[model samples]
Target: MGIKESDIKQDAACTPGLSNFFLKDHPDENKWADCVHCGMCLESCPTYELTSQEQHSPRGRVHLIKSVAEGKITVNEQFMDPVFACLDCRACTTACPAGVDVGGLIEEARGQIRQAIPLTGLKGMVSKFFLKGLFPHQNRLNSLGSILRFYQKSGMQKVVRKTKLIKIMPQHLVDMEAIMPEVNKPVRKKYKNQNVIKSKGKTRNEVSFLTGCVMDVMFSDINEATINVLTRNGNDVIIPNKQTCCGALHVHAGDRETGRKLAKQNIEAFNDSDKVIVNAAGCGYALKEYPELFREDPEWHEKAEKFAAKVEDISKYLYDTGYEKPKTELNTRITYHDACHLAHGQGVRQEPRDILLDIPGVEMVHMPNSDRCCGSAGIYNITNPEMASAVLDSKMENVPEDVDMISMGNPGCMLQMAMGVQKHGRNQKIVHTIQLLDWAYQKEDGKEGL
Candidate 1:
C-alpha cells in the first residue's frame, strides 16, 4: 500500500498524450512491429469475422497502435474504438505467425487513452464506481453483493416480474435479470473467521483461493464448488481474508492505476501459499499477467512474476494434479464452450474438455466454433450489446443440439451462455467445469447430478 506519487509517472516524453498512459517500458514497439500483416488472424478474430472490417481486426488494431507510437495518429475515439473493440481474447496471438501480443497491445493502448481522456458521463460514473470505488475494496464489494442478495431473496424479484415492472427496463436488462443466478451469501462469510480450509485427506499442496469479485457475488456456489473440488483433490485451500477482486475488469477497462493497486494487495495477500488458485478464466488471465502491470518497476515486477507463476485456473490445476475418475454417472450430454481467456489467454483448451470426457456417462459433443467469443468480453456485452449479442447469436447457433448442459471455466462465460440459452429458449444449463467435478465427487449414486 506504500504507493508513492512518483511511482506512477504523470508525464513522460512522447507524442503529446501518448507516452503518459503507456509506460516507457511497454506496448513494446518491437512487439507490434513484428506483425507481418498476414490475414490469418482474420478468420480467428470474432469481431473481424462478424464485421469483416479492417479496423476491428487484430493486424489493423496493431497498425493503429503503431501509428500512435510513431505520432501518425492521435489517440482519439477513432484510435480508441478499434483498441477497445478488441476482445483482448488473444485469439489473434494464437493465429499470428509473428506472435504479436495483440491483447497486451490493446490493453496498453487502453491505459494510455484512459489516462489521457478519462471517461465522462454515465459510463464514467459507472466505471469509476466499480473499478476504483468498489472492486479495490473488499467490504464495499461484499456490501453490494449483500444488497443484490436482498433484492433476490426479499420477494422483490418476484414482485418485479409478476407486476411486469421490468417491461419498462431495457430488454437486455430484463433478459439479464431473468437469467441472473439467485444471489447467495459471499464465500467470505462461510469461512467464519477462518483463513484456511484444510483438505479432508493427505494434503498434496497448500494453495490460496482468489474468490474473485463477481465470482463471489453472483456465483457464490461456484466458489464453494471450487473449494470442494480442490480439497477433494488433496489440497489445503486458504481463503485469504484480505484478498479483494483480481481487478481483471479494471485492467481490461484500461484503469491500470487501480489494477496495479489491486495487484499489490493480492500479491501480499497470497504470498504465503504455494499456489494462488482462480476459478474464473478472466481472473486467472489477469492474475497470471500481473507482472505486466509493473513493467516499469523492476522490483515489483519480479515479485509479481513470482506471484503470477503460482496463479492457476482450476481446470488446468486439476488436470495437472490428477484426480480420481468419477464413479457416479452424470448421464447427461454436454458440450464445452472454451472461455476466450482460458483457451486463448491461458492456452488451456484440452484440460477442461478432458475432465468432462472422463466423467462417466457424460456424452462429450464437439461444439463448432466453441472457442469463439460468447460476447461477454468482461463488460463488452453491456457496453456494446448489439455487437455482443451478434457474437452471442453465432455462439448459440453453434451450440450442439440436444445438449443438456454447456460447461465452461469462467463465470462470465457461464452468465453469458445462460443469457444465450434463455434468449433462444434452449433450456440448457450453463455450469462451471469445477462445479461438475464437485457434483461428481459428492454424488454417492445416480440420483444426483446438476
Candidate 2:
C-alpha cells in the first residue's frame, strides 16, 4: 500500500529571518542530494528494523527532509517527528554506495526544527534543561558528576538499578536510564598534565583537547587517558581554558544563536592549534560540522572552516600520528562499536579499526553493523527514550558473544554499551579507545589494558 496522502502533516513554517537556501557557507546541498534511496539502508536502520515503519527508514526521512528544505513540504509536527526520530547512526551511510551523508541531513533537519517550530513537550523541556544545565557550564556539570559519583560510591545507584523505578518508566526511558555507568571521579582542574613526557624534538604534532561538557563532568578519566596517549605518542596536548561546550546539544535542540556563539568561542579558543584533538567522537563530528552551522556569517564561516579543518577524532589522529604496533600482545578478543558521529559524520572508516588491530595481543572483531548507533545521540536517549532503547536493543543482538571487552570512540557510546552489557547480565567491560591503549602501553599483563 502506498503512503496515504491524507496522513501527511503540513503547516506554515516559521523560518527565522535567515533563509538563504543556497548559501555555500551554510549546509552542502551536494551532500544532501546524494541519496539514491535504495532500500539497502532500511535493513540496517534500528528504528525501521525495530518497528518496520516506513517513515523510520533512512530513505523515507531523506525525502521528507529534502522536501522541507526545498519548501516543497510544510514544516509541522509531522515532518519533525521523523526528523527527531532518527538515531543519526550513519549505518545507512555505511551501506550507501553514494555516500549520501544522512547524518548531515538529519542535523540540517534539526536546525530547521529549532528555527521553524517550538518543540515543547515534557520530554523536550527535560532536554532543554540538559542543554541549559548539563552543557554550557563546566562548573555545574562537574558538581552533578560528583553527585552521581557519590550515589555510585554510596550504593544508591546500585540500589536504584536493582529496583523497578526505571522499569516503571517508559521502556525507552528505562533503556536510556539503564545505560549510565555509576559515575567515576570528575575532572576538577582544566589543565592538569599527569605523567606524560613530551618528545624533545620539533614536536611531532600539537593539539588542543576540547574537554567537552559531558566529557569534563561525567567520563573524565577518558580525558586523562586521551592526554596520556597523545603526549606519550610524542604530541604536545593542550586543554585550552577558553573552550566551552561544543554546542552539539544546542545545535540539535534548535538554539542556533547560542550554538553559533559557542562555535565562534571554540574556534577562537583553539585558533592556534594545528589539530583540535577531540577524543569524543560525537564532539569531534559536531565540531567539524560548525562550518555548516555558521555558513551565514562570512567571518564566522571563515573561522568555522579553519576550526573545522583542525578538528580530528583522536583515534584517527593517533592512527595518522604513527602509533607503533603494540609491543605487548594482549591475548584477548574484543569488539569495536563505531560512534555514529565518527563513522557517519567524519568519514572515519578504517583508522579506529586499524588502531585496534595494531594492539598485538588484542583481536578486534567487527560487530555486525558496527557503524549503527548505540542510540545515545546527545539528549536523544534521554528525551526519546523508547525509540532509543529499541535502537539499543538492535545493537545488543548485533554484538559478538564472549568478547573480553568492548571499545568505543565516545563517552556516550561507552556508557550506553556498558549499560547494554549490564542489561544482559554479562561480564564484558567497556572502555574508551584511548584508555585501553594507555593500559596496553603500561600494563605488563595485557588483561589490565581494559
Per-candidate RMSD, Å: 4.3, 4.8
Candidate 1 local accuracy as lDDT? 0.84
**lDDT by residue (tens digit), candidate 2, 358-389:** 77788877788788788888777776877776
Tens digit of per-residue lDDT, candidate 1, span 345-369? 9999999999988888889989988
Per-residue error (Å), model 1, residue 285: 0.5
Q: Model 2 residue 401 lDDT?
A: 84
The global C-alpha lDDT for each of the candidates, from Candidate 1 onward, is 0.84, 0.74
**Most accurate candidate by lDDT:** 1
Least accurate stretch of 10 residues (summed lDDT) in model 2? 16-25
Per-candidate TM-scores read 0.94, 0.85
The true-versus-predicted C-alpha distance at residue 291 of model 1, in Å, is 1.0
Q: Which candidate wins on TM-score?
A: 1
